[model samples]
Target: MSISLSIHGAAHTVTGSCYLLQSGRTRFLIDCGMFQGSKTLKALNYGDFPFKPEEIDFVLLTHAHIDHSGLIPKLVKHGFAGPIYATHGTIDLLSCMLPDSAHIQEMEVSQLNRRNVRRGRPEVTPIYTVQDAESALRAFSPVTYDEWIEPAEGVRARFWNAGHILGSASIEIELTTGLDSPRLMRLLFSGDIGPEVTSFHPVPESPQGLDYVICESTYGARERPQMTLASRRDLLAAEANDALKDNGVLIIPSFAVERTQELLSDLLALAKERRIPRAPIFLDSPLAIRATEVFMDHADELEDGEAFRHAMRSPLLRTTESAQESRMIERIDGSHIIVAASGMCDAGRIRHHLKNHLWRANATVLMVGYQAEGSLGRILQNGTRAVRIQGDEVKVRARIRTLDIFSGHADGTALTQWIEDRGPVSRGIILVHGEEEGLTALHDRLAKKGLDGDRIFAPELDAVFDLLAESPSKRERPAPRRLQPEVVGQLDWHNDLSRLWLDIEEELEKAADDKARRVVLRRIRRALENERS
Candidate 1:
């Protein structure tokens, strides 16, 4: 009787979190998250699962974040029919999130196909449709936090509140071979643990007695400011006041889940006290509006219930649902705050808003969450003078501000303390859900605390940890597989050149006449020749 853990995704990257645990005759998955960020990483979403999804017994979801649960629909579409277990809050969030994700895919593919038709290229189908997402929702089985359950043979599992988002959790699983076997293994998967205290969600509880722990290191190398939620709110109010004084549009690219609710709560407080002007506050993403309702439904379970109620009832918070309503927002002429999704600004209505307002000197773009490398938000955060949005280069004259207090993940100090609280154990501590540098920093920190080098693993993508079959003391470090010769991404010249050529082709297709098309081509050719010179 042996158990093995396979790292499918989020091994050394911040997104696409999937893990497979095979215990004796039973097989199950913890997460089936979608790959996001770079084109190379996002391209992995189109590839087949390394293992057959139908063979898995069940899925144990840790949260409802798209990066953690986004690929569940794809799994179901690929023939996985087992129950997908999660907390009630996560289940409820998924009810809307999955459908929204599917809708985004539908919209993106529709746009891409239109271009493909014009260019005589083959049309591509969406990875999964809205119907597939709806079908996936039927498989959810809600479980209560802090209760143990046997979802499959020889496996017992429990969920603890992780304080990351609404109903987010860290899962603990114990597996035993048989009554005669002396071997019993326990594994803990930290599903995006949050800070010590959050205004929106309750603080997470640290669990002990784990033989092996799989933890996240998203902020393993950075420390957050020691500020209370009230102070953070004060800062937000100051920013709003400044934006209002400038008489410019305030744009916020916010996550559609917990971050939206938190921001709304603070804004509602500001509105009550008249700290901000009586301007229209638009919640532009329909997905966010639905998620806010879910937050409202679970208000009693949150930390600041009264605040949540006040935020939900705010009259200034307007929601735009239809295409016409969204378009109408672009035409409005006034000092207002618009919160849109695809938090990183890679997709969604935020791109449209950024295109319309980013060039205005009076506009302000407030970034409120983690922006992965190569994301448009990161580009703005890095102080890029201009950015390409939906095929047009937009000058970034608008002020870009990042409020780190809104982040849900715990920082370096909090993460270290969480790891230390686990008590002394001679077992493996596997790091995932972070970039290489952050993971290395965390691994070094753990080593300084007396954890042996052999016991600490920073797994590469697709690396496997054979838990039951091999002891940490005897197991050798896993080598990374050759996925490619070198990393290919937004900075890769080949990728950039291809994209530039595609943009030129699209612009030519939209030209009114051959003269205009020739003008476009000549400009491109001249630009290339100038670059060569």
Candidate 2:
């Protein structure tokens, strides 16, 4: 018997969430995601999987966010025929999201390949296609809240409403794995906990004592996120009023899922109350329009969704067609708000709007979501007055503003409060899903109170730790960039056939005969030949 956990992704960085757990011969993986952000990291999207895809037994998804679920199509293409577990709502969102992600991949990869051709370099390909995404969608297995869904022989799991997003869940897992027998252990995975006490949903209960808990710290070091739903409501009203005075466009870059819905609902309330001057609001991005509709379908998950009990209210101003998006952008009247997707301003119609509006002093640019480093949104957030959009240098004269309210993640104080409420239990703590600075801040704060003996650990990318397996003779793990010698040979870095002899010698040391070892060597050489030509 053995127990091991491998951090496949989302260790040092925020995106590409994945981890593998093993008990005896059965292997389970959680959150197979695509990496986003910088080019170097983005290339991980095209990497050869560390393990054989066919060997994977199951996949547990956290939600439908691209960073958390975008790689599913690639997994399916690689021959993974396992059950992909998620909530019903997540399934709906994925139905909309996965196809869109593939579309973006195609657009981006084709552009990159064009540049590669110009530079006399090898052309890269999209990891998967739209058809692959369709195939992957067929593998979804939906589970409800508080229901135990067993994955393997010794693992029992259940999902709780995390209130982070529609159908987002915090999972509780019980694993019984022993070096020689069965030993019980409890584990909890926080699936992107929500904005505390927002206008739409109530904050969920802090998951309590367990043998081990894997909690996310997305905002572990920040102060209450600097915004709330109440403040955001007021801000929206005030901004709309100000923009009405000037009669200019208000461009909002928002995530397609919950954030877009929250903004629309807030705007709808303002429209009903006449709190601000009335103007036609544009809900651009067909994907967002579809997502908002899906959100409304899940009224049972919303707190104010019950407000419909008093009187039925429309959720968001969903523009159904691309023509609507174009018509609004082309001929928008004074001071109207326009919301679009690819929240980072890195892509989408927002780019067109920024090019159209950024130079005007009367126009306003409002940011609502967390912009990762290197995105156009971050440049705007950092107070850059001018930036490039679509290869053109554009001046930024619009009054840049931010209302970080409507966060779906719990902040530092909330993380602390949740931890304290969980009562004294096991001391071992593993901090995940945070930047280095944020994780350090939380670690120091927890250190002061001595909760659970401060066994806090933030594992490195690809780090391996075995809690139940006996420590083997100390051997350094291979670097991630180094896969098989065949992969290395494909680079044409080693022309000599015997270049890999030493490593092969060590690898086949325990073989019974030289004949068997030579066969293995021949197979590796053949694989190298395939990759090269």
RMSD of each: 4.3, 13.6
Flag regions of model 2 displaced more than 4 Å: 111-122, 225-229, 306-320, 423-427, 452-454, 469-533
The candidate that wins on lDDT is 1
Q: Residue 17 in model 2: shift from native, Å?
A: 1.2
Taking the tens digit of each residue's C-alpha lDDT, what string does model 2 give over 428-474? Answer: 56667666666777777777777633366676667665644222221
* Clash count list over all predictions: 0, 1
All candidates' lDDT scores?
0.84, 0.73
Weakest 10 consecutive residues of candidate 1 by summed lDDT: 482-491
lDDT of 1 by residue, 387-506 (tens): 777666777889899888888999887887888787554478889898776788888888888778788887777777667545665443354553441452233453365446556766
Model 2: which residue pairs collide?
427-452
Off by over 4 Å in 1: 178-180, 469-482, 485-495, 498-533
Instruction: State, as a TM-score between 0 and 1, how close model 1 is to the true structure.
Output: 0.91
